[model samples]
Target: MANSLSDRSSGGHQAPKNKKYQMKREALEQVIDKHISNIEKHSKKLPGTFDKEDIHDLRVNYKKVRAFLRLLQLEKDAGDLHISDKLKSLYHHCGTVRDWQLFLEELHDVGIVDQLPDCMHRWHRQVFTYKEQTVHAIETTHFKKLLHGIIKELPRQLQEDTVKQFMHQKIAAIHILLLAAENEKDLHSIRKQIKDIIYCIRIFKSDWGIPFPFRGWKSEKELNEMASSLGDFNDQCLAISLLQPSYICKCDYKEQHILRNLQINWLHQKEARQRQLLYEVQELHVEHAF
Candidate 1:
């Protein structure tokens, strides 16, 4: 991915002649189709698949398409990313499964789930149930219509000049978020903003490759590292909150009681993750728009 990213931004296969920053019409259409297809591919593969990466990839594809729709939506006259209530249900179903996956993975990582076999088993069962639910949503949802709407919205040419200007505005917004961020929500805004940059580039690339942040910007790896840290802290925070007595835990009262007894361990872990994320943010230096 890193090598391909470098190749793309450095005037490789992604951009058209003269290696312009913008994508061509045909390239943009291919990108749109690719993401829609990949979303289906991952959603199908996740039904009985044990690999968590598939779930992550499915969500990534969802975000990529959603980002493109969002861009078009902002233009008002272009198009809107208006998901039907049914489609929104499907989207949330996927999220439900992902949260279960994250909830378990974090517990297992901290050795909490490992100590309680029953809790782990219950969590896995819940994940399987939600996974099947997501599969059902995929099979029944009107995604074909949603995808067709996006295809119909394609413009004659996705000029680089327009995309570059849009990205510059987003980066400028990120700059403001960075200086004003005093809490985790602010950090999340920063992370999502960087991801918007990434999603836009990958949406245009045929290979779904991440593009190098335009000239005079942080490397793709560095940007990912920053996002990773913030994501980790977020997962940790979620895991801790799930342990609270009011949460609708899948574990029984007895098991939930046992889990709550060890809540301090997860709390400590969350604090450690918080510090790591803060350090990452402190060292982060957002260069002005390219």
Candidate 2:
């Protein structure tokens, strides 16, 4: 999968010559340029620094770029311009490291680290090794080429449309999905859909004067807050899963027992949080009458 960003410029692609679509095309190109630059900056530093925040930021930028590409694809037939899978693999490479980092932080916050220092230390070493391998996979010529290609081709793929109408259509689809979502997994998917719509709005709204469609149910702030809550619920689920005996076999019997107990408690907490979040999502959907 592609990892590092290449220095290949967008090949000096100019905005559409047609005056009617000039501003819209420029807005699209600007959004693509900004994200490509950000992704490149962070991806280049990955091999040298291997910082957790860098990994996170790179993934975020990748998502932004992917979301922008998705918008283009939705607007027009962007054949051979879809780079979601390659970017997704790159994101997952860093995601493993991120998940472990978050898991470690959760352990520390819940006092598990202090109680089972030896076990935590051993797990930390394993996580470090995994991160090294992931980084190694990322810092390659193929990865660089992939990043370069996406940035180089994106501007050419964007087509002009009424920004406000497009935004309304996309957000409305996401709202329908949110209204139909019934469980934690569904809620998680809804959060991602909402995130994509937010990215779309952010890019278009940067240079175009388009107002958001939803009134009480959707705003950048509201969507972000909802996604954050869902993120916490997801982290708890992952933490409990990682605490399973099969995964933490290095732990002694006493440590294993402690982990099992912690897992059980977290499971209960996750259930409650999931329930509350689902209710909140339902309420928002109703208020919006999607």
Candidate 3:
């Protein structure tokens, strides 16, 4: 698998100081610097003959950068460095391609491809066209400019704060949110927050030599398991979302029957996954409370 920016370490060459631990402004700066460089490097490859991994890496890195920005609450700072919307739009473009790829891959993995009705080939072709158009959009000068602008502004937007304090606040906030979640949308939000927190913790550990400060709650491994569960659920949701639109169109009876079965299975899986996620969330809340 091609390594996404998130997969790479933020500190490439810098050595952590042996002095007392502090989450200085420069720690965040180093993260932004590395991410910006990674984004630029990956974006350059986007216009080439890239595969699924390339697009996946590009999108994941972009989200890491955005997550870092949000972590620092810098999105609206002075209104000059607000690039979340641009990054989000670009991220969505990548997601569309990725989701389609995953959808097909899911079918193949489940032995459903061979069983799929012939009319579903039309859906596959439609996904191909969508991927092509999205890739072309990435090649635009405007997209490049937006990426460059983010790279240029992010360094100047970082603020100094104690790493311990930052971690506590962010983690506590996420815990509260997770505890309050009542539905899939809320659970999805918590998953994203957990991911961002884990990313930041890893960066601090690898780049700044700071250890994870939280205790008696969730370990990184546990958090990763939770995220993976949520990810599977989200994938099912995306597959269903993409499949639903084609339902309204006219198709052969056999085709419709297969499609309906696929949709029903996906929906059933999603519901089961939701219940499992909710139970996990409840467990997380209990662990955190003690």
Candidate 4:
């Protein structure tokens, strides 16, 4: 995942014949069970505050489940997909907690905790409130039972040929997006696409060392770096957006003075990151074209 295992090539998705390539039903079932266990283990109603890393891992498992399901392209309106509505509900609820926690962490990283004690206190308490909602959401989710129903609907196996074709389509679409990207919002879209690819690739790695089907389609490591950069900017914007109004209603003169001093510096950093992301998006070449 760090670098392309296969040498770069154009216009093909074929894997070597001797390689083990199919996603067998048994393997898929095993992966689902493992992910379900991980979700339960991490979300187990712990007595103290949940560590940020644990929350992150829990959300990742949920993404893995959804990404694999999407890779299969199972349909709902006309076909055989029965992903639970509760699963989506739980994912979103957990996300609410993560957002508040991240905003708090970002503040600490920037040394704002001591400078803005009242603001920090409000956000810290807000994280607990969101976590309470997540706990209730977790209690209501029965992923084990839900996944059992899903496994029953799955096919006997998914061939590598089908998987490669889907990946090719995704790569080609990413190229189009790269060519068309014009702003920070477009870069955000690109980040989502990279994450989807990474999640699907990781699913295979969790079972077998399934070789990624395409070369020059940026390695997982490279995609992660880009995603990380985009995420930092996104988080900064969201934190400031949410915190501004809450602090604005205050009559505290000192808080107002501190924010006024920091606002320009923050805006400049955000703009610089935006431009860098745009350049990364524009760097794709013919080899990256599937």
TM-score of each: 0.79, 0.78, 0.76, 0.82
TM-score leader = 4
Q: Which residue segments of model 2 deviate by more than 4 Å? A: 1-27, 84-86, 141-144, 151-180, 205-219, 285-290
Who wins the lDDT comparison?
A: 4
> Across residues 7-72, which tens digit of lDDT does each residue of candidate 1 receive?
453443444435554334455556667777787777777666736787788778877777776555
After superposing all C-alphas onto the true structure, candidate 4 shows an RMSD in angstroms of 5.9
Model 1 pairs whose backbones collide: 22-160
Model 3 CA deviation exceeding 4 Å by range: 1-27, 46-50, 74-80, 84-86, 115-117, 141-148, 151-169, 207-216, 245-250, 285-290
Candidate 3: clashing pairs of residues = none
RMSD of 3: 6.1
So what's the TM-score on candidate 3? 0.76
lDDT of 4 at 83: 65
Give one digit per residue, the lDDT tens place, for model 3 in 1-290.
12222333354423233333333334555666676566556656765355787777777667676656665653334234545454566567768878888877877777766665565577667766776666665555365566556555543333333334455565676768766777778787878877776666665566455454444354667877877888777778887886674642565666667778888888888888788788787776313422
Clashes of each: 1, 2, 0, 0
- Per-residue lDDT over 1-290 for candidate 4, one digit per residue giving the tens place of the 0 to 100 score: 11122221223344565564555567666766778678778888432667777778888988787777766653222126556887777777777777777766776777866877666566567777777878887788886788777777766565655566666766777777887787777877777776777787776554455546555454556767776887777777766665564654462677666765666667787788778778876764324444
